[model samples]
Every structure is written in structure tokens, then in C-alpha cells.
Target: MSRRVLVTGGASGLGAALVTAFVARGDRVLVTDVREDASVPDGASYLRLDVTSEADWEAARAHVEEQWGGLDVLVNNAGIASGGRIDVATLEEWRRVIDINLLGVVRGCRTFTPVMKRQRSGHLVNTASLAGLVHPPGMASYNAVKAGVVALSETLQFELAPYGITTSVVCPSFFRTNLGASLSGSDTVLQSIARRLIDRSGTTAEQIAAEVVRGVDAGRPVILTDRPGRRAVLAKRFARPVYEREQHGFARRIKEAAEGAADRSTTKDGA
Candidate 1:
């Protein structure tokens, strides 16, 4: 039987790819996003949803109840990008990211839990990041939130099992996508590095989405979408000393880039 699937942030990027994938599989797919309904993929239905709003989530739940009866898969894939050093990033930035990235997923899980529990079956797929497993310098907000997702997903795997619910957390490295458009941070160098990585990555959203589908279908608990992401997690787990060394080197690069930015400003001022 075809599954009833709902994906948050499904208007574009990885979420759009996911919708297309499920639709291709003959599944009944619903695409929800902050964007206009017109932007939803061709084969999937669209719903105007802002994950930050509880009213929106409640509406989504109601729509599922009225339309699909019960949902088989819920992809909590909505999030934003953020990066900066400790001193450079503001507390307000921290709050905004926490609200959207972390709290957004929390809201999604809570809203749909009752539905799944009533039906006695559901799967939750969360989009985290490689930074969640291996934290690098700069991007404290993003790292923290993604890590929270990982922790939450794991907890739900155990907590929701009795209700016939499964959870999968995705940790994908930089891929070509519109995710960078949402990035906000004070550290120019860190932000530039993130943009460059996104622009230069060979992996595409479709590729990551495909991996996610396969993982979810196979009932995998954790899914790493790219080789770099898998390698990074492996290094962090079994090669702790090496991982620490790489982290230290990355920290040096951040420091040097900051100094370079300061020197350029000083030169421009003097000129």
C-alpha cells in the first residue's frame, strides 16, 4: 500500500526533492512550507505552513486528519543556517535559530505524536547536519540545534516504539541547495566558508533525498547522506585524537581569517 507522507520545508531544496521522490514512488505526498503553494512539486499536494507557528502545525494536523486519515511518515526537515564565533554571534541570533531550527522540530514532533499514537503507526525523519555529530569552530548555533535534533530523534526512537513509531535522523554534509540563502551570521569568514562549501559540493539535493528515502524505507535509525558526512562521523567516533587535531586546525583557520579581515579593514581605513 502507498504511504501518506508529509514533508516540512517541501517547497524547495532537499525537501522538494524528497516530495518528488515519494510522489515518484506512487505515495500520497503532501508538501508544506512557508513558501507559496505554487512552489510545491508537480505531483504532490501543497499546504501553506510555517513550522514556527503552533497554529500552523495544528492546522496541518487537522488537514491530515480530514484528508489522509492518518500519516505514515512525517519529515521534520524545516530549518535555517547560521554560523559565527562565540563573541561575534549575538544572543538574539542564538534565540532566533533555536526558535526555528530546534524548537520547530520539537513542535512538529509534538503536534503529530497524538495522530500517530491514535493510529498506532508512524515514522519521524529529522534533518540534522554533520556538524551535529562533529562540531567545528564557528557555527555554534547551528551545531547546537542540529545536535539537539540528533538527541531528540534518538530519544524518540525508544520513547515512541511502544506506539509503533520509528525515528530517523539525517546528517548530510554540504550539498548544492538554497539552504545558504537562509544563512545569517556576523563572522564574514565563517559565513563565506559555508557558502563556498555549499557552492562547491559535488553532492546534490536529489542525491541526499534518495539516500534518505532508502534509509527510511529500510527503517535505519540514523542516516548519513554523503561520503564526507559518513567519514566525519567515523573519525569523530573511532579516531578521537585525529578528530580533535582536525578541529584544532579548523579553529586556527577561523582565527587567521578573522585577523585577515581585521587587517583589510585597517588598510582600507588608512587609505
Candidate 2:
């Protein structure tokens, strides 16, 4: 049976990888994104969707209803990258991030819940990040929104289960992707760290996508997409002192790197 799957932000990066995976598996996929050039994999469909817009979500629902009759899977994967210290990131920036990252997913869920409830069987995949589970310093907006995603997914896992629905929140560690292109933050220190991590990660988006698919198929509630993230979560759960130490060390590294960047800037200005 070919499942009806809809993936938001399916133009590039992890979303694109997921679209490809679904297509390869003979699923009927609707690839949606706000971008005009949202790439649709072969044998998949495409629709323009801005998760921030209620109208767009409604249109998506209509499309699904008319095209597939019902949706078996909905992947809320649309979000921008952000990293900033609490005070460094302005209120406007915080609101913007929350609107798209958190509220966006909220909109997607609201749009599709009725459809799934009627069908009495569906799966929701919400793309969060490792930051959602473990809060490293700097990335307040991203961390907060992703954490909200985790909470929302968990809530839906319970709320929608009665309707025969399953929810999975994907918490992927740093992976090689163009997510950095959308990265926004006033804190240069954290922004640089995030960019570097994304650029240097050994994990590819395809790897994460495969893991996400497996986790979803298995009906896992919390899908940690990488080994390091899994270990971090385990440490956080069982080794409190060790987790605290690691967090502190990571924060110190950010501070030292910020100081180094400032020193280099000063030297350049003096010259």
C-alpha cells in the first residue's frame, strides 16, 4: 500500500532527503515549501506552503483531500536556523523564530488533525533538533522553539493516540546541510559556532532522513537522529553531574571563542 505523505520544507536539506526516501519507497509524497522553487522528487507532488500562514495550511489540507483523499503521514519540517544568547537576540528576533519554528508546526497540526481524526490513523513527524533535548549555551530561540516542538509532539502523542494517530519528534544532532544559510542571530559567537558545526558535521541529511523513517515506522515517540545525541540524552537522564559538567565546558568554549574573535577584530582594526 502506497502511503500518502506530505512533507513541508521539502526543497532542500533534510526535507529533500526525506522526500527522496519516501519516493524511493513507493509512497505518494506531496512536497510543500514556502519557496517558489520547492523541489518535488520524481513521482511526488508539490504545493506551495508557508507554515506561518493559515490560508496556506488550509490550501494544503484541501490539496490533500482532493488528491489523496486522506493523509497517512504529515512531516512538519519547515523551520529556519537561529542561534543567539538570550539578551543578545532581540525580542523581535525571538518572536520571529517562535512564529515560524513553533507556531508554524502548531498551524500544520491544526490543519491536519481533523483529516487524521476522521481517517482514524495517521502519523505526524515534527522536526525538532538535539538542542530541543539538550540546551547548549547560545541558541536560545532555536532551543526554545525546538523544545516547544518536543513538548507539543509529546502532547499530541497522547492526545491523538485515541484517534489512532502517532507523533514523532525528530531531534537530530548537527548534520551537513544548508540550514546555515537561514541562520540568523545577533550573537556572532554562537552564530559562528552553529555555522561551523553544520558545515563540519560528519552526519549527512540522508542519514538523518533514513533514521527518521525507521523511527517513524517503528512508532517511536522521541526520535534522536544521531548516536551522539542519544548519548547526550542518556547522560542527561542518568548522569546529572556529568551532564552539568559537559554543559559548562561547552559554554566555556563559546565564551573563549567569542573572546578570540573580538581579539582578532581589534587587531585588524588597529592595523
Candidate 3:
């Protein structure tokens, strides 16, 4: 069965890749993003959207309804990155991250859940990062927002199950994307760390997108994209003390490296 799908952040990166993949699968997909362009591939519709705004969502919904009657799949893939220590991060920055990464999904659900409920058979996929399950070194705001997304997705899964609407939460480790480049605007410290993490992480946008489509096809409620993430979650559940100890040591090592770089700067200045 072909699905009428709507994807947020569909102009670039993982969203773009997902949009393309869905189209290839013969699904009618609506791609929405803040930037409008002619680059969207053939057979997929494109719409301008600012996920932060209610008016934009309303318009997009209207467009989807006019064309497809109702959506079968809603992929809440729009998100932003946040970095830096919690103590040093600005209130404005925190609000921006939360509004886009967390509230954006909330708003999408609020607007679309009723539509899906009326249809009584639909699937929702929310993109939460591996950061949602286990906090990496310094991404306090990103971790909080993504963790919220994971919780929200789980709650929706149970609540919507009664209505025959399925929900899946995707937790991808890392991939090459402009996410790190954008994070640099908000926090150089976080951007630098993001660059390193992406360099070391496995999986690609296409691979994640394939898994997402498969999970929806399988009616899965939670989808972890990589083995390490699954292992980390299991370790946290079965051996929490060991996981905490290891996480603490990992964090300490990152902090030590940052301090070491500062010491090098001091030495260079003295010379």
C-alpha cells in the first residue's frame, strides 16, 4: 500500500534523503522546509514551512488535505542543534533549541493527531537522536530536547495505539550532515565536539531513512539505528553502575582534552 506522507525539514540532509526514498517507493510525499527551492525531486510535492509557526503548519495541513484527503505517514524530522555547558549556555539559546527541537514536534502532533485519529490508521515517526538515550559530554539543551522527544513519542505510541495509529521513535547515532555546521553558530565548543563525534560515528542518512521506512512498514514503536546505541541502552538497563562509571570517565577525558588545548595556548603565549 502506498502512503501519503508529510516530512518536515525535507529540503536537506536526512530529511531530503528520506523524501527521495519515499518517492522512490511510490509514496506521495510532501516536502516542507523554511527554504523553498526547485531542487526537490520529481514526483514529490514541495511546500514552504516554518515548523516554529502555527500558521505555517495550518497552511501545510490544508495543502496536504486538499491534495491527499489525509496523511498516512507523518515524519517529524525537523530539528536544530544546541551545544555548550548548561551553566554557560544562554537563556535565549535554550529557548531557541527547545522551541524548534522539542516544541516543534509537539506542535506537529497537536496539529496532525486529530487528522490521524479521524482516519484511524496512520503512522508517526519522530526523529530523536542517540543523545536522547545517553547524554554525551556537553550537549545539555540538545539532550534535554531530544529526551523529551523520545518520551513524547513513547507516550504517543501508547495513546495512539488504541486508535490503530502507530508511532515510531528513531534514534540515530551520527552521520555526516550540516547539523554540525549549524551548531557552530550557536556554540563553537559544541560544534567542535560535534565534528569529532560525526567523524567517529557510523551510519548514513540513507541507511537511517531505509530503517525508518522499514520500521513503519513493520509497525514498530521504537527504532534504534545502530548496534552501539542498542548496546548502550541495554547496558544502562542491566548494568547501570558500570554504564555510569564508564560515562563519567568518558566525560572526564573530553574535559581534560579541552583543558589540555587551553594549556597549549598558554604555553604559546608565554613563548
Candidate 4:
């Protein structure tokens, strides 16, 4: 069935790819982002939205309701990653990450779920990250926000199941895209984390988009885009002991690095 889909951050990266895929399939897609340029594909309609603002969400809802009558699919894909240790990160920075990545999805759910409920049938697709499942290093803010997104998506899935509304949270591995390039102007630790993840990640936006289309078609509750994502989830689940051991090892490495820096300072003083 052709669906009316609203995709946040649909102008670029994974969102753009997903919009293209859906449009190709003859779906009526409304692509929205904070900045809506002429770069989007011809078939997909463009709209301006700042996912963090309530006003923006309200306006978007009104616009969609006016045009599509009601939404069949809401893809909450707009998110920004922040770097550094939890303690080192400022409260404002933490809130900013939460606002865009976590609360943005929450707001989408708050508004669109009612529309879905009215129709008694609709799908909500959220894009999380592999970091949400695994305790990765140097991306505390990003990981924390994504973890919340996953939890929220899971909860919504079960809560709305009685109404025949489906929600899918997509946890994607590192993909080949300009996601890393955009990280350079960001904070130091965050830039480093972005480089490590993007450089070592092997997935592609196209692959993620294709998997998402398939998952939506199948009405899946959770969409893991890469094999590594599945492996990570398994390691975190059935092989919990191993996952914890690896996390311990990672902590030790950080501790060792800290100790090495302290020792270097001590030697310099003695000299």
C-alpha cells in the first residue's frame, strides 16, 4: 500500500536516502529538516522543521494534516551526536543532545501517535545507533541519547500494539557518509569519536535505507541494519558476561592511559 510518510532530516545523509527510496516506490513523502534546500529529490515534497521546537512540530502537524489528511508513517531521523565523558560534558550540551535526539522523537510520537490512533493503523520509524546497544567509548552523550530513543521506541511499540500501530527503531552501524566530515567543527572528543566510528564502520546509507524499507514493509518492531548490530545485541544479551568483560577491559585501557599521563608529569618534575 502506498503510504504518506513524513521524514525528519530528510534532506541529507540516511534520511535523504530513505526519502529517495520511499519516493521511488510511489509513496507520498514529506521531507523536512531545519534547512530545506533545493537538493532534495524531485518527487519528495520539502518542508522546514526544527525538531526541538514545539511550534515547529505543531506547524508541521497542521501542514501534514492539511495536505495528507493524516499521516501513515512518521520517520524520526533527525539527531546530532555529542562527544566527551558524561562529567566533562556541560549540562547545556547534554540537554541539547537530549532535546534533538530524544525529545524530538518523543514529540513526534506525542503528535503523530494520536493521528495513527484515529486511523487505528500507522507506523513510526525511529533511527537510533549501534552505540545505543553497546557501551562504546568517548561518546557518552550520543550513546545516552540514543539509548533513550531505543527505550522510548520499544515502549511505544508495546503501548500502541493494542491499537494495531507499529513502531520500529532502527539501530544502524557506522555508515559511509559525510557524517564524519560534519563532526570536525564539533567538540574535540566528539570529533574523535565520530572519526573512530565512521572510519571503522562498513555500512552504507543505501544499505540502511533498503533495510528500513524492508522492515517497514514487514512491520518489524526493531530494525538492525548491519550484521555487527545483531552481533552486538547478542553479545549484550546471551553473552552478557563476555560483553561486561570487554567493557571492563576498555575501562582498564582508559585507566592505563590516565596513569601514563600522570607518570610522565611526575618524571618531568623530577628532571
Judging by lDDT against the true structure, name the best candidate. 2
Assess every candidate by TM-score. 0.97, 0.97, 0.94, 0.89
Residue-wise C-alpha lDDT for candidate 4, range 187-216, written one tens digit per residue: 454465467767777788988899999999
Clashing pairs in 3: none
User: Candidate 2 residues 74-147, lDDT tens each?
Assistant: 99999999878777888989998899899999999999999999999999999999989999887778889999
Which ten-residue region of model 4 has the weakest summed lDDT? 184-193
After superposing candidate 3, which stretches have Cα over 4 Å from the reference?
Answer: 185-187, 264-271
lDDT of 2 at 150: 97
Q: Is candidate 2 or candidate 4 better by lDDT?
A: 2
Q: Candidate 3, after superposition: displacement of residue 203 in Å? A: 1.6
Which runs of model 1 end up more than 4 angstroms from their true locations?
none
lDDT of each: 0.91, 0.91, 0.85, 0.84
Superposition error at 130 for model 4 (Å): 1.7
Candidate 1 clashing pairs, residues 3+ apart or interchain: none
Q: After superposition, how far is residue 53 of candidate 1 from its true place, in Å?
A: 0.4
lDDT of 4 at 61: 92
lDDT of 3 by residue, 84-190 (tens): 77665788988998999898999898888999999988888999988899886678888999999999999999999998899999898788776665674544555
> What lDDT score is found at residue 64 in candidate 4?
94
